[model samples]
Target: MATHRLTELPADALKMIATIAGPVHDVEMVSAGYNSEIAARLHLDNGTVFVKGLRQDHPRVWTQQREADINAFTQGLAPALRWEIRKGGWDLLGFEDLGGRHADYSPGSPDLELVLQAMRYLTSATPPSGVELKTMPQRMIAHVTDPADVRFFEGSTLLHTDWKPDNVLIVDGQARLVDWAWASSGAAWIDPALWVIWLIASGHSAADAESLAALHPAWDITPVRHIDAFACAQQRLWESIARADRPDEWTHKLHAATQAWVEHRG
Candidate 1:
């Protein structure tokens, strides 16, 4: 989908944003995401604010609302939500501009350590009250070969399953996570397990990636049985996605990596 610049927003929508964000003197479209139709930084007199949205009629329109809801509970982990608006046939959200670079997880990089620190802190967080999020077990029920493997992921900790380098921002020597579309409630260990795949993709050996993740308390204490279950489940899930009618190159790469990780588990 083509991303829309702020100037492209209808006059009413621009007025609504200006009201909440101060007079917008400039607009810069952000090209990092795939789903957003309108993602930009509005330069107000006071400061820059990040905005992301999509057409109201889009099939995944509900994701914008979900991100807003999740943002309310993401105090320390993600940028704060400045406001949410549904105007001019669009549903948009404004967030505090976290001026930082995306984290790098390659071997010998310092950013990986900071990311682990953030993940450790995240494991201690309780989900905010009154918000509905899918449980990891619920989300993965269809992917695992054995029904019992689902129990391995049943827990109360909030999980950030997507660990691509693009989702983590490094600022002030700390790693701040972004993109809450896939946030779910699950065992704390599940997040570290998910990161292992990205770590490998970043050129770390499987053993080294496991070692880096082991620095987290959650990863250290994860039961061997549970780890085995999750490994097999992820392999099955990626296999199905990569083998689907017409899989893309990225999907095939991930499928192969997951398969290697599963074999490494043995």
Candidate 2:
């Protein structure tokens, strides 16, 4: 998973980007996520645009197309997709430049409020017609200890299940979500449930994380059984991921937080 600086892209790829975004005067690589081989802010004479892409033959190349397809239906929470192109063995996407800092999920941080606001808005959204997204039950079927546990995740709410703090940006006092690669259609409560794990990873106690999750309207009225089931299912899911990937320190921290939530629920 080596990263490619803007300059390293082949002439054909640069030509394709220039065709849509005008000449690139400068390129600043975004060092955040690892999925992209090329991710950076391209500074043009007129303005800046964020570009991300990967090798066309990569197994996860479809995620590039998926992000573009879902961006149109994400309302304003995600940056608008400007264009997508295939060039020089790469699939690339350009997005509106949102010059913002990654969200801070630590307890008592004001960014927490903004992130919750974005989550609440997202929970109310219905996935646009003809978008074939996997339902939560289908997604969790492999992770849940009991197949019946997956039933709690079944619903039509468009859930952004990846709650990594870096995926959220606090721009102009509003929270904007990025990296829609894992977006799924699921129960409204699922997002908050996922956020609780992140909150814990950011140093909030399990009780405080649950308290923060309470800010979401959907979480307030969810059945206790469903909550418990989801907590158990997510713990199992993260545990499997941790075991399989042997992720880095931060991911292991989040997995530990998920385990704490499961114990708290028990």
Choose the strongest candidate by lDDT. Answer: 2
Question: lDDT by residue for model 2 over 15-82, one digit each (tens)?
Answer: 88998889988878777875677888889988999999988998788778878889988968999998
Residue ranges of candidate 1 with Cα displaced over 4 Å: 1-15, 244-249
Alpha-carbon local distance difference test for all models: 0.82, 0.85
Stretches off by above 4 angstroms in model 2 are 1-12
Weakest lDDT window of 10 consecutive positions for candidate 1: 1-10
Per-residue lDDT for 1-266 in model 1, tens only? 22333446556667888877789998887767555777788898988998888789987787787788888677888999988889778798999999899998889999988999899989888766677788999988998888988998989998777787878999899999887877899999888888888887778777888888788888867788898888888888888887677675656766777777887888
Per-model TM-score, in order, reads: 0.91, 0.94
lDDT of 1: 0.82
Worst 10 residues of 2 by lDDT: 1-10
Which residue pairs clash within candidate 2?
none
Q: What value does the lDDT take at residue 129 in candidate 1? A: 68
